[model samples]
Target: MSGFFKNAFLIAKKDLYSELRTRQVLGTMIIFSGLVILVFSFAFDPAQNTTKAVIPGVIWVIIVFSGILGLNRSFISEQRNDTMQALLISPMDPSSIYFGKLLANFTMILIVELVSVPFLFLLFDFHSIGSVGYFLLVLFLGSFGFISIGTFLAALAANSKSSEMLLPLLLFPVTSPILIGAVQATKIILSNIEKLPDAVAWMQLIGAYDVIFFVLCLILVEYVMEV
Candidate 1:
């Protein structure tokens, strides 16, 4: 168990260092997020009273799109430098590679969400920071579900000719439940709707999705690596 975690952290550290040095993933995500925000600003009237009602949907939409950008590139860094094959050839178990990739992707998505959330609040006038902790929890759980499926799909599509286009097509449909759960949870929390039961139910659904996908990814990663 210790060995697995050690290997997983090692691979995760390598990914982190590589990303820190290159900034490819972070840079692209930030730019993509900015563009999404800019588009929203133009498409909707920020001066109107209806803005708050629309903010939740817009925030989740931005998150989902930016998340896809992050996930699509999660394995590209390894594949680009030929490090993926090195990891495969290493003594680490295949699950370690999956965990490492999942952790790295999670970290990336978290960073993007952290930056994007405040920007979102500032731009959209949606101040739910009092519940920031809960918002983050939901984000992390939702992101875990996305990243779990994404890590597996990333490996599957890594060698494809049009991986960038193929990944979202394969991923978005399968992960719609995550989007729904996250958006509903965010709405309940942000609107202070006092409907804890509804939010709790969605959160529980998110948890179930995360657990199911994580285990499925762990089981299927070996097969993905083999191919």
Candidate 2:
């Protein structure tokens, strides 16, 4: 158990060091998310309170799209440099590799969300944002759903001829339940602080999805890598 965690942490640490030095994924994610917010702001010309209503949708859009960019390269970089095969044959458990990539992608998405959420509110003219703690919790749960399966699919799709296109196609259907739960939960949170109980079902759904898919993906990664 210790060895497994150590290897996973080392892999995650390597990806983190690379990101700090290169900033490729982070840069693209910010630019893409910003453009999305900018386009939506002009397209709608929303009123003051309207931003609150649309904040949930806009936030998820940025998350899923920017997450795609991150997931796309999650495995491609290793494949491109011929490092994936090397890593695969190393002494580390294959689950460690998946967990490492999952951790790295989760970290990147968190950074983007931390920066973009404020910009999202700013662009949408949405003040009076309610319950910062709950908002972050929702974000964390939603991210777990996206990132867990995303890391799994990324490994499978990155080897394909149409890997980039194939990735989103493979992802969206599986992710729909989580997205719906997340969007609705966030909407309830932002609109009415007292009505949070209404979203308990959705939060439970997100939590279940995260737990199920996380274990499923972790179990299947070894086979996926073998293929």
Candidate 3:
């Protein structure tokens, strides 16, 4: 079992190193997210409470779209260099490849969120976390759901002519429940410390989504490889 996760980490490290060297996915996502946030910020003056009210949704939009754009890298690199075939033909477990891809996507999204979120929260004047630990739990559960489904769909769409287009159509509707739950959880977490019950319920929903999709992808990826 340790060997399984070690392989996943090794693969994740390889992608992370390549990402650091090339600045391919991360650079584009940061620039795009920054621009979108800036545009959205301009649309609302500080005097209006509307921006504050919409902070959770705004953060969700920023992360989701940026992630969708970046998720292409999950399989494109492998598809491009014929590495998918080599990866499959090698002795590595398929679940390792899925988890490795999931790790990279998760790490990438977390970095982007951490970098962008301070400014995001400051911009909206939100600092209402009941517990930092619980807030991070929400973040991880939410991101897990997003990346798990995304990595699977990205693999399925990697070879298509209109893969970029296909991914959004395939991804958004199926994942909307997690998105809504995450936004609600964030809004609750950021608004009042007393709303622990609401936040926990949403977290449960997000966790269930993560677990279901995660196991489904682990089983289905072998067929995705065939596709």
Candidate 4:
């Protein structure tokens, strides 16, 4: 078991190192998220109650879209360099590749969220009335579920001719439950302190979503890689 994790960590380290050298995925996510936030900040009246109502949705949308950009490229780089085949033929468990890629994708998405989400809140003049720790929890659950399945599907779709378009089409519908839970939890936290229990309920749902699908994806990704 320790060896399994060690190999996964090495794969994740390799991906992170490559990303640091290129900055392709991280740079695109940050810049795109920033631009989206800027556009929305100008389009809505921050002081308006209507804007507050919509801010949670907008914030999550930005995060997921930026994440999709990163997820779309997660496996493509391996395919392009022909390392995917090498990795597949390696002695390590195939699921380790899925896990390693998931780690890398989750980390990058979290970094983008940590940077952009505060700026997004500031731009909309919004502040969380609830616990900031819970807010981060919501973000963590949402990102984990999204990235878990995303990493698997990315490998599944990486070889497709229309992977760019195919990824979002497959991803969005499948991820809707967690995304909805995330948005509702975020809305409650941002808008009403008294609704903390309600937010917690939503968080519970998202956490369950994360656990179920994450395990399912881990089990399925090995077969995916075989094909």
RMSD of candidates 1 onward, in order: 1.6, 1.2, 1.5, 1.1
Q: Model 2: runs farther than 4 Å from truth?
A: none
Consecutive 10-residue window with the lowest summed lDDT within model 4: 126-135
Give the poorly placed runs of model 3, Cα more than 4 Å off: none
TM-score of each: 0.93, 0.96, 0.94, 0.96
lDDT per residue as tens, model 4, 61-157: 8778999999999999988759899998888888888898899999999999989988888998876557788888888998899889888889989
In candidate 1, which residue pairs clash? Answer: none
**Candidate 4: C-alpha RMSD after superposition:** 1.1
Residue-wise C-alpha lDDT for candidate 3, range 1-227, written one tens digit per residue: 88779988988998899899989999888887788777877887755766677777888888899899778877888877698888888888888888898899889999888877777776656666567887788778888899889998998998888888899999999899999999988888876668889999999999988898889999998888774
**Cα lDDT of model 2 by residue, 175-203, tens digit:** 99999999998998888778888677788
Better of 2 and 3 by TM-score: 2
Q: Rank all candidate structures by their lDDT, best first, as comma-separated numbers.
A: 2, 4, 3, 1
Query: For model 3, which pairs clash?
Result: none
Clashing pairs in 4: none
Q: Which ten contiguous residues of candidate 2 have the minimum total lDDT?
A: 43-52
CA lDDT scores, all candidates in order? 0.81, 0.90, 0.84, 0.88
Q: Extract clashing residue pairs from model 2.
A: none
